[model samples]
Target chain A: MTLCTFIKAGLLGGILLAAAPLQADDLEIYGFMQVSGSSQTWDEDYGASLEADGALVGTWIDHAQQANAIAGSEMFPWQGLVGLKDNTRNDISFNLQQLNVILKKRFNRQWSSFVNFEVVENYKTDYAQESEWGSFSVQEAFVRYAPSARWTFKFGKFVPTFGNFYEIYNRTPLQPYLFRPLIFEKSVGGILPPEDYLPNTMAAQVSGTLRTGIGKLDYALFLGNSEESYFAENGRNDTDAKCIGGRFGIRRGLFKAGVSGSYDYDRLDALDLGNDVVLAIDYKVPRMRYGVDFSGSAGPVSFVCEGIFVVYDLDSDQQAVVDASHAAGTSADNTLDKSFFYAHLQYDAAKWFVYGDYDFVNDGIQPWGKDGVNALIGGGGIRLTDSITWKFQVAQYSYEVSVPHPLFGAPDPLAALGGDLTPVNAPAAGVYKGTILDVQTGISIAF
Target chain B: MKYTLTLLVLALIALRATAGVSVIAHPDVDAGSVDKITLADIYSLDLLALGDSDLIVFDLSDADPVREGFYAAIGKEHDKMKKLWLRAKLTGSGEPPTAVASLEEMAREVAATPGGIGYVDSASVPKGVKVLATFE
Candidate 1:
């Protein structure tokens, strides 16, 4: 229906459903603002060796991937945005951003449904290009049913139910810095085209939390077709992937630890040709507790860290295809056996908090190899009001690789491909470093 | 002095006895049939409050204490259910049950309504109506 018709219909329903006057129930209005500035370093020799790494080297085949190269590219230096929030007594909320509109509703006390539409913009950077950046599309739409207070069953499009930063820390109210983790920002393939990391894929997921005698157990069962075929005319196929995994953790008082993993099968016609699987473990504990003499006393200081390992199972045919593409001087074969680790410490007292995180991603399986990525991020914030906060942070990312490709003179293939037409199989590696200084603040309130 | 004191005490007791309220009921109802009513039960039962202008319905021929017993169990000092109904109505939520002036009126009206919930003197209960609970 048209926007006008939709609005009219809601108003008509409101009149007919009017109930007891709302006097005792509380109502409030809230939202937030965030602004950040970042500086990055590229391989001093980023024009070559696009074949050295899977994340960058494989981009040579997909034209869209070639555009994401940041080396030999101009930097934005600074970016910011303001978002609005609206919540009602019945547990419903609305957030509108550019072409995207999000709505959430809680049914009775156990179930809820949410829908988010994002408009793509038409813009291109060496790193990626979003075709419909300024256009509208459903970013996340799903229904969540919670049988108890701690578990949920969600079916629809949502962020992958994995990784710490991918879930909770990504929210504006909780994040320590304006930018996401570097491994996520730089290496992970987006679920969407161009720079769309963790693309909007359609799937049905059953996830819940369990309280056992030992501690707590959480699991997720997911099944869905490749994001590319989700919206197609005939979307369901045997080739569709299935995922099942669970996280086991123990929490006694202020300390908690858990491990989570998932298995993925890549196929075109139900014939599974390759697989991608990942396992991760995370732990958090209160490291210190101290009080100051002033009325504003500091609370407990905590430490959190996690490690993730990804194993690739490639079939002979897949290996042959990459070999053939490489012989033609066009394919950028980038694949790696590696693990990513991150550790951070956070101290929160009253409305003020400070944190420091170190992230590491190895490009290959060799010990002390000359190929890897490491980053350090530090930031802190103070709450100015119940719905508003301000933060400042600094970050740095560096890459280590030995080989250099000839085409783009960088360590990766996107540089070799030169522009949007770069082959997906090229490889490039080099040490690039820079510091990010960002100051951001925002407000959020619910009614 | 002791004789005079005893005589004075007897006079005071006589006066107090005459001043106390009297409970009335329909002639057919068994006056001593029921036991005590709980606070929770009374709330769920949705009993009505009695006032000077209110018209209560009951058969006068039964010997049951339905009317007198219920009458005694109501008011600010007894049943809280009456107040809850009034509060619900004032808040624009629940509607209070209707009042009838006679047993005949009550039976004829309540028998036709769906989920018909009403109260009458135990002695005045009609053929179709069911007696859920009562108090002495």
Candidate 2:
């Protein structure tokens, strides 16, 4: 069935269940809401030069100006290549981050069902501006059966067990930071995309826990449709391959650790031919991701750490094709390997909390000639009441573009104008440095 | 001497106010007593069934001192417990225990429900319920 149809059917089922007369012990309705406002300031220095045959053609700041002009414009296809201007500017916005509702019913000791509906950024379907429209979706709808204490099975759509934070990150009231770590921030349009690093949802899952002598051992296995592009026509696998993953961990008292991995096929519709031109090339490459995560607490201080590695395996034929495109003036080196890491520390008291975390991502594609991006974030929160919390955060980001691409010569069309004319075979290696300072404040309420 | 006697009486009253709590269950429950680990598992919604019957757990409001003492005895913090319950409820694994306003209500609910469990002050051990464990 189509996703829209499935959502409508799920909502109808939930409404019908709510209308029925059931005991208080059988049905439950709960949810939470979060709203926030944020401001960002940028400071960047793009001291790049164009040269021909080892001689300087021109030294201009126009590159930085052009980058700034298309900072947030998705319509500009070359925005990714030039990167953002990161120039001295300030941007502010207020958003209803999320309003989530959950309906659950217990049919018996062995069977139960759950449904979660979410409205984010005040979602409007007909709005013209992207910022004016949000999203409304059914995050999860699943039925669970537990025949014994050590075995439980689930079917439907739900987030697979991966990492320590992916499953609970959206529960804002439970999180210490208004802005989660980069890997877990689904709403943040960061350089590192979480979908590339982890599996977000699965069709079926089997999970259980064992009470061992030392601690409790937990394990989960899940299956789902293969990964698809963000703009895929439908949320179905394009190939016969499916995504499979699992996580295993142990918990004792307040400390727990887990290892998780997934295997799938990624469908890519476009290929980067080195320069600013976007080429459509359809290919399904084998992808594998693995990660480790651990969390623990000592009195009032709690900390969590996680790291993920992704590898895209291309056959020799595909490699040769990529090489041919690069030799034909596209850029030869094309790699899709990526790695990410983050560490978070928080001190929670009776009525308040303070936290700090660091995030790093290395994109092997190097769309902007940058090796990686690093972010250092700090924040704190106050518990206004049992169900209400107010939080604020400050984050600093550094985009490291330490190397210059050989294929990135000044556009021939621009050079023909003669304003800063340069018939350059190759551009001189230049450093591109950019940074952003972001501040945010928000409140979350749980009911 | 009179002042010392009055101070002694006040201390006794304070001791009674901070008395220990007892983990009580319906007489139909099979288990006679539960260890600290088992208690934690059950109250956290990690363990849904005890023996052959499905467990029906009840809780007192957060403002109750007996509720705090019960969690401390199980080696869990209030905030952490709330998070655990939220995760359980959202994931469809389990639901949070039904909460009653006072100890008297807790006793009454557990007595009327099958496979029921709750906690209350040890000094006020009401009738019609079986004390599974007591913590000081």
Candidate 3:
């Protein structure tokens, strides 16, 4: 009856019909599971508001992170495991921190269809009213078609091909932390929904492989609605927002280099909010049976910093939608712009790796005035098998702004008292700071 | 010495008849599934090249003796199986051979399907199926 249900039914029917002869023996099945523990510490208290003292205020402390102090240490179970193959029974699985399914059917030799699905935790209702098992969301549903030896066309709701980590699984070899870069989290166009599902926003894409003089070349082009859209008699359209992008990469000897870029136009609902553009590049070399990946990028920054040095631009147009959705009737501040930049380095050998990351983000104001989340993270991993891995990490963080309480107003007494008692000028009205010890292990199997 | 040479010549002539591979089959079946099958006939088969059977319908998996024989006898026309799979996965055109779990399953699958052909241990040959050749 619902949109989601209709989509699921249609896809399922398509697969069954395609498997008419029904060779159960032709299917392959695979999957994995994982568990972990983590601890967190904040630089400020739960509501780290500004004190009477100004310069001496900002500090880390809290059960939750706000503008005042740093919050630290939270732990839980994480999934990890993967199966490399299967053909006896038609099934495909991927182990992320979540259980993902890859459903595919081989229609003869030249054509086949595939669908990738992920489960998302919906924290919409009262946690108490919900079942402990958690709810699920279909992160991706699409079909891929390769009609030639080096070219392919795909249609459906799939992650756009914009960033290296967006389409590729396994972050140990690409990013520095288990979490994404700050720029990735707060940036406008880079932080796609189903955060961990894929990269860029959902859209249609065309990509392919080509033989070069020395090795090979890979490229892709994608088109999608920007961060905002207007629903009309004809369905959805960019109206004022749209995202168009592409990625190019080349392989030579033991090295690979790539570049990605995208332009976003955001509006919809008759409001001229703003826009965004992003450019990124990365290079990698494999030696000693392992390798190193180095990456960096910059754009019209408006994203919030999850850690130091990392940055991303906010999709002003999309933010405007949420802002409009909750207009005067609610307490919501629609962020219009953001500035971001960062660099990361990682070394991966077989199943083991080590990494480091940094970020810096400012939204529509002086970098320091707009409270920032500056952090340094380091970590490592141990491969239990070809499909499972264990991870360990630590982070050091600092905050720039403070949250003034309801009573304090401007130039509060807390500022006069001196040491560590200033107001934090940030998107969230509170002070924040913290340390965290993250220990987790998981496996991934695919078939 | 002359008598001994004459005796050796007689023995050698007797060996040639049995030296070639035993291209066996079900007496009722007209086509041969052997090391040296006809190119036109080979192409017609919906064949399963087991382990290393050198079913050069399109290409060879490896460049070895059986493969060499197939190409040598058929002329240079086919491609390698490895290249074909890579091409299919990358280009989205054709698919590579399905990797089956065992010879028994391969035989059953091939036998049940028309135009199907695959390899199995000589001892396991079923009644409906026929042995095309013995490589050894």
> What is candidate 3's CAPRI-style docking category based on DockQ?
incorrect
lDDT: which candidate is best?
Answer: 2
Cα-based lDDT at residue A400, candidate 1? 34
Model 2: how large is the Cα RMSD against the reference?
6.8
**Candidate No. with top DockQ:** 2
Q: Model 1, range A340-377, lDDT digits (tens) per residue?
A: 67777878766788888887766332211234556777
| Model 2 chain A, TM-score vs. native | 0.77
Candidate 1: stretches off by over 4 Å? A1-33, A39-101, A118-137, A186-202, A226-238, A267-299, A320-335, A363-370, A401-404, A407-447, B1-136
The iRMS of model 1 comes to 18.1
Per-model TM against the reference: 0.47, 0.82, 0.49
Ten contiguous residues with the weakest lDDT in model 1 chain A:
A285-294
Per-residue C-alpha lDDT of model 3 across residues A1-447, encoded as one tens digit per residue:
356645655664565466555547444222222333434443332223322222222222221222222111121011121111111111112223444444556654334665544432212222322222323444455566654435666666666665444443322222224444454432123222223112235468787666566655768888766542333467576254456667777655334556665565432224312111111111111101001122332221111111111123434554454455334212113433343444555565544767666654443222122454465767667766444556666655554433332323333333443424323342244433333333333333322
Give me the displacement of residue A83 in model 3, in angstroms: 54
Worst lDDT run of 10 residues, candidate 2 chain A, spans A78-87
How would you encode candidate 3's per-residue C-alpha lDDT over B1-136 as one tens digit per residue?
Answer: 9999988987775553223322223233345555443432243222323223323222223333333443444332233233234333322223444444554555555555443454444445666656666543
Q: lDDT (CA) for every model shown?
A: 0.39, 0.73, 0.40
